[model samples]
Target: MSINNDDITPSKDNEIREPMYGMSINENPKERNPNSSNKLLGVFYGIGMNVNTIIGSGIVTTPGIIWNLVKSPIVVLLLWFVGGIVSMAGSLSYVELGVIHKISGGETKYLQTAYPQPRIMMSYLFSFMHIFAIRPGIISAVLQSAAQYFWYTLKEHQYDDGIDINTNGWKLPFTPFWYVKLLAIAFLLIITAYHMFNTRWAIYINQTLAVIKLITYSIIAIAGIYRLFADWPTSRTNWQNSLNGNSDITAYSASILLITFSYDGWNSLNYSLDEFRKPEKKLIFSNSISVGIVILVYLLINIAFISVVPAEAILDNDKSSYETIAVVFFYKLFGQSPVTVRIFTALVVLSVIGTAATGIWSLFGVHLLSYSLEVIRYRNKGNLKKEKNDKELNEKSDRSSKIEYEVSLFFVGIFILAGLFILIFSFMVHVECPNYNPNCSLREKRIEQMSPMLISYGFLIIALLFYLFYYCLDTLKRQREAKIIRIADK
Candidate 1:
């Protein structure tokens, strides 16, 4: 129970300190570096993280399911707004806790403090680690998606000369697993380099991606709406009919849930609480604007998608919701030449890379934070090298010596562990599908295989355990402190 509770409290029969959590690290986390306040990316950096978290494969995948479930174009656009409100509320709640905690583990950190018990802790631990211990699957999905778009882009390039770009040309070297591993390594390397060398650069990249994503989504949405109006569908319904339309009650309930996930990233800025100049003001601004912007973009994008691709086709064919919709709309309108389809796909892919990179970066922070905690205990009171080193080195080297060791150990461990965790998560997630006909797109397979347990269980379990453990420790600390105060008054 020294000033910092980064680690647990000391185990003693009687100690005159607040019973804290965890133990043993020398480094001052707060003192890592003088944050270079970026004048250019002040607000936009948070926006980037927001967009990055939300716009992953979700955009490409979720919209199709939504299209299938809610066919009305008006409801398709409106659902995004509803999703935004719920997620934004969660973001606001986090901002309040984030200031109180002021650490990077985001909601996970708060849950640990608030819950902190055995059963609850274990469940959350299992799922949390399972999902993002490394993020191999997520990274792979992004890369695989990127490659698809890349292949299509190559087709566009080949079109000017009237040569059919052999889609199979790159297929041999780019096996699914191989491409995933490569993209995982590549994105990790890029993010690591940015964060380690300069965080400002990382934020800058996040912001730039956010801006681009916002603009592209807006344009696509506007374009879609205009096109639909130009040739209004024989079946057009305003908000009243769209909401109460024959769309099944169960379907709308599901759409409500799905759209919520689609706009899941409104609170991305909460994770970067420490890095913010004035997190309090920033959180309000960042979360508010981020949710608003995402909802707007998502609404428009879906409107565009449905306007082009009939709902029935989208429902029947789960593969390629956004892209297929785009192809139908753009090709029929722009002439189904190979070039135009390629161009549209290129934009979608380009837009999502920055989105994917941001997610990798955020998940990386989770490992880094948890690893830092682990390092503190791994060093065991920073006594490892102290046993071997001279009194001179130990004394003059200062309290931070232990911290340096922990930090070093943290990065090394996370890299290895993260990679392995990702592989396992990916495999488990893969199993959600029994037979993968090598012909089926991995994307569709993943959607089919996705387990809702992946998202909800971890948070639920962690919240419970985290509350219990911290409650006992906090209660004991308070009683002990009160006794000490009484003695002093005497």
Candidate 2:
């Protein structure tokens, strides 16, 4: 569904009249006009979304990877704590920006307001990179991870009755490579279709999943605490030797990057401020509460993992068998029971799914809608300007303008659909070989192909160049308009 420009953009009545941080929206409070069809999201959903998006697969997967990298549990926990601080700082900055702009579109709106000299170039660049590259990459990666966990869980359950179901290869007899790809695609379609049809229900489902995520983490943390107390000797030894490992500077930097990624969705609420019931009061509260919960839960969960699974074990654990630190933790705590491991793996899959759902819902509903509206507005304005000089053209301009707007929308819709299709299917098609063999030419070829990181950055570079090109054209246009005014005056 499209967002109405008038609803999202700040009206003169809603203009900033006080300090941004201390701004009040109650001075001229309009009665809440409730729309059943398009309900505004509340602060509760805001917190839910932040929590759901922020606590995705990263927390479950990265602890072991970080421990492997830094070889220091102390450094891993410190990096995580630092990451939380950075995310909180970012949330505050976004709160201020959201308050000042009082609009949706997040960075797109902020960039336009902050860099108006270049006319809408910054906003366009942000929209281009975000819509085409960043958002899609994130969604695809999350869904792919979710699919892997789901398949892993199924394979584990299959082996419950003494049947060895080999899950080492990319393609197994029971679970083919296409099965995983199709599962991921099915996840994307189901979530996308649900959000498309039922906005209110989608938010409700997100909130429910957010609660489930919190509960899942709490269970892990509590279990860890119990283990720590039950077996203080092991826990104490692990904690004491937390820093007793090789701390390579390069690995430390890389671990920090991973922690930062874990903290990514802290600013998700900024994307849909206009959908909020009362953004001014709720923005800071929602962000603060969400980040705080994630920080506490993350630290506790790490402690829980450390309590049961030592840093050496984390570093030496077979990643092929144990996909995440959580799996290792559960196995250490509950022995080698497939049922217990499958349960936690299922939780991890749910966490990943929640993150994907929130990402797609926000991107499709707010970001794309905002960008499309911006395009339509720009086209209509240019058309109005051109029609002013020719009487005959002015008469037909409305019809032509209508046609142009519809065509622009049609192309935009097609572009978004095509991008989504490519993003989902292409990532699924190129399955990374689980165990790299020198004879695996297809895996080597896949690695040689352009990486998603390079492609995303390439788009950003192109965006900057586009901004510069458009900035020059906009400056020239303004200069000509100024010259015409001066000549008319003479």
Candidate 3:
């Protein structure tokens, strides 16, 4: 419970009490939580994680896709409800596993705890997409998306001339050459600094930001809903057939893909397992409550979005279902001046950025914990630790762990910047608006036709394939090995 600075010294007798990073991984993690930052007020922690994990980058973007799939506002809300149920089910499944496993990998971590050795290997391999593909890709996508908004704000405010809106300088420093790079670097630095400072501060800041972001969303939701019934859309049609389609696969797939991102962070409470007050109760409690709140928030937000703007308009997404909807709603009531639109855009952007930051920090913590465990608990025969002096052991472990943390921070930074750069280069994968040209009136495009969405989605498919193939193969191999081991034990 205490810092135990005196016992944390290099003395041989003190070694067993230290954490893995302090040569304590061998010292019994049950007795020491390397990542515990704060006691985490029961409800607030769930709220913190819920706020951190939910309200992700998907919110501003997913409505159109949902509406496209299910054209009715009533159906759209219903679908989100279905999505939340599935999300909660998955979260609850992890609770049993998380309590049993007590490892830090979140989803994969739970799998590893169950299977242990060979199973863990397979889990990580399958998770290469999550680890290598989806997590990084998705996180990068958010930061980059935020970067664009920041770029947009800067462009709008920075330039003396009015916005072209279309031909924005997406560069950092706003110059033609390295403007993108500069902003990318700035984003990385911000992400790295927060994570590096300390987990306690990081989570605290995250929780605080989550609250503000939630409030902002609450207001927007209220305003959007007020406008909806205030002057409910006069025209309506029965497009249920076009929306869900008859195929169950398409319906469910459509539902899963859109909501997965929004519901991705339900496991946030699990990742910091060591930090909780009583993990068993706290974990499930936090997850359930946070997800419940998020469902409410998401449903309200969607209701607000579709309520103010018609399903047909949102489905069209000509100027971004999100922005266009916001623009129309505000214009009807508050008057969508350029400033009003900009501020609204900024709010959504902030929410997304906060989610991205929280997710990346979790990712970093996973690596940091795994590596620290390796360096401390399982000493390599080739490492020549037999000759290590007592006085230097604590110092060396701390130094190495700090380096590992720093290196992880660097890659995380690079990943964010690289993903953003790649998206920008790949024709705005990280940034897209509904093709809202005042000239062209038919706002909607076919699914395959939208370029940015198509590309990002294509990558998503590729990543999923990678996760599926690798994990399946790895799982089979591990299961075979487990059978052999059980036979041997018998």
Better of 2 and 3 by lDDT: 2
Please give the distance, in angstroms, between residue 397's alpha carbon in candidate 3 and its true position after superposition.
28
**Candidate 1 local Cα displacement, residue 235, angstroms:** 8.6
Candidate 3: regions farther than 4 A off:
1-41, 117-119, 126-128, 151-186, 197-201, 233-252, 315-332, 380-490
What tens digits encode model 3's per-residue C-alpha lDDT throughout 285-376? 77778788888988887867665555555444333434324444444455547687677667766776788878787776467554553455
Query: Which of 1 and 2 is ahead in lDDT?
Result: 2
Let me know the TM-score candidate 2 reaches against the reference structure: 0.71
The top-ranked prediction according to lDDT is: 2
For residue 153, give model 1's deviation from the true position in Å. Answer: 3.5
Clashes of each: 18, 0, 12
lDDT of each: 0.54, 0.66, 0.57
Tens-digit lDDT string for candidate 1 (64-136): 6665567665667667665665666565565566555545556556666665554236434643553443254
Residue by residue across 195-310, what tens digits does model 2's lDDT show? 88988798788777777777788889999999999999878877777544465554565566667677878878877765677665778788889898899989988888877885
Candidate 2 overall Cα lDDT vs. reference?
0.66
